[model samples]
Target: MLDALGWGAVAAASLLVGAVLALLRTWRAGLIGGVLAFGAGALISSVSFELAQEGLRLGGPLPVAIGIAVGALAFFFANRAVDRIGGRKGGGAGGLPLAVGALLDGIPEQAVLGIGLASGEGVSVALLVAIFVSNLPESIGSASDMRANGKGRGVVLGLWAAVAVVCALATLGGYALASVAGGQVRAGIDAFAAGALLVMLIDSMVPEAHDKAGNRAGLVTVIGFAVAAALSNLT
Candidate 1:
């Protein structure tokens, strides 16, 4: 259980690091785009290796499929609600989607971490890096955009901090859930995270990165995938 919290904190801390970086320097659009693309690739690797495959190994296709469907639908509706609210709140800046994506991604990601801990097989370095690396660009881009849009530093930091806290706590929740869940349920949880992550990347992160970095984003994303895939092999 402590492992879950510790690992969750480690993963979530990247948001704070990104928030601090945003306050210190203005990141270029191209730079942020490359980071987002790379993070997107890393997330892909995590979904492929750490979540989907492991989920399949745990439970059959039925639960995984069901979980994925549920997860995708959940994200779709929730994201739509957030978009409506954001539209109504007129003063919002551009990076709100990135923040929302990060917040959504982190919960299941951290929960999977907890589930892994409960299984006693240790955590996946690839998944951990995916969560951590992806979080940095989201918080940095969002915080910077917020700061640029006349928001105070405190508000930006506080917002990210809240996200981080929520994600960290999810690890504990996952751990607790794992204690009671069957193999099928665990598999479903893993699939759920992957589904949510895939939708988030397609709906928000990928498009945003492509819009900012153009052709460069594609190469950077491939590189990120290769690197993360290599890390999974190494571990």
Candidate 2:
């Protein structure tokens, strides 16, 4: 229970950082891109180095391959669904759907981190740090969208808090199951998460950053990835 709670708190802390970014207005496009890139790197590193390593340590190549495919497909389809629905406004309010979509998109990566942490001590702290870095861009985007749509600061913060709750619950659940699963199972799961993170990095973060801020933001995105890679190496 304590372990689960700890993971939940970590997840919430990640979301809270994102919330703070969202609530602040002076943050520039380059900074946001840098943050997103940082997150992208962290997500990639965690899945690739830590979680995937543990998963393979327990399972074999087959499970790892299957997990990667599964994770990739899940996020790919989810993204496609988002693109298809992008044209539609949400229940007389569009921002809500965007927030929900962003929140849901974060779940798989966080779950994988939770599972990694559950398996060992080093990974838990590492994932917390990684995810915290990743959540910054998300927070900025969410908060910016809300403010643009005329939502109050309270609404933005409240919505962020709600997302944090979900993140905590998801992490807790993943951590709980990590112990029952062997390395192969974990490896497979990590593969899937890795695929999902890759897709998100390519499909969302990079393009969005480029679209929003052009060349300057794009460079920061790479810097973000480099920082994350460095951190992964440190771990």
Candidate 3:
């Protein structure tokens, strides 16, 4: 359990790191976009190779499929609702929504980290790397937006710090829940995380990266995917 907490905290710490970077520097949009594209690619590899494969192995196709569908639909609607409420801009005026979306994205991934710990597979280095890398761009972008909107540095940092803590707790929660969950339940949870991640990449990360980085984003994304995939295979 302590191990789970430690790893969880470590994974989430990137958010604070990214937030600090954003607060400290005015990042070029192209650079931020490249990072976002790379992170998105890593996440794509994680969902495909880590979550989906494991889900298929433990619970077969049907349950995992259902979980994926439900998770995708849930995130889609929730994201839309948040957008309507003020998240439409993705930054600046949409800081709250962006933060909320980051929470939504981070929670499940962190939970999956805890789940891996409980599964007796030890830590999944690839998943941790993927989550950490993916989180950086998000927090950076969101923090930059919040700053642009006239938010105090303290407020922005505090918000991401709080999110990191919550995500760490989520990892602990998933570890605890794993004690009572069977294979099918665990598989469903994994699939759910994957589905939510996929939707997030498609709906937000990819588009934003492309908008900012143009064609270069594609090559960077491929590089990210290859590197992550290699890591997954090696570990």
Kindly list the per-residue Cα lDDT of model 1 for residues 1-235, writing each as its tens digit.
7888998899899988898898998788899889888878877887887778878988989888988887778778778876787678776535666777777767877787787788796876765676666678778877877787787889888988998999999989988988787879878887887788788889888888898789999999888788777776675
What 10-residue stretch in candidate 2 is worst by lDDT?
A: 89-98
What TM-score fits each model? 0.91, 0.78, 0.89
Sort by lDDT, best first.
Answer: 1, 3, 2
- TM-score of model 2 relative to the true fold? 0.78
Error of 1 at 121 (Å): 2.1
Query: CA lDDT of each candidate?
Result: 0.81, 0.64, 0.80
Indicate the residue-level lDDT of 192 in model 2: 71
lDDT against true structure, model 1 = 0.81
1-235: candidate 2 lDDT, tens digit per residue: 5666666667566666676766766566556555655555555566666557656776877887788788778777776665566546442232343344345545655566667667675354545566666666666665765576577988888888888878777777777787786666667766776667667667676665666666666556566666666666663
Off by over 4 Å in 1: 91-93, 124-127
The residue pairs found clashing in candidate 3 are: none
Candidate 2 at residue 182, lDDT?
67
RMSD of each: 1.9, 3.5, 2.4
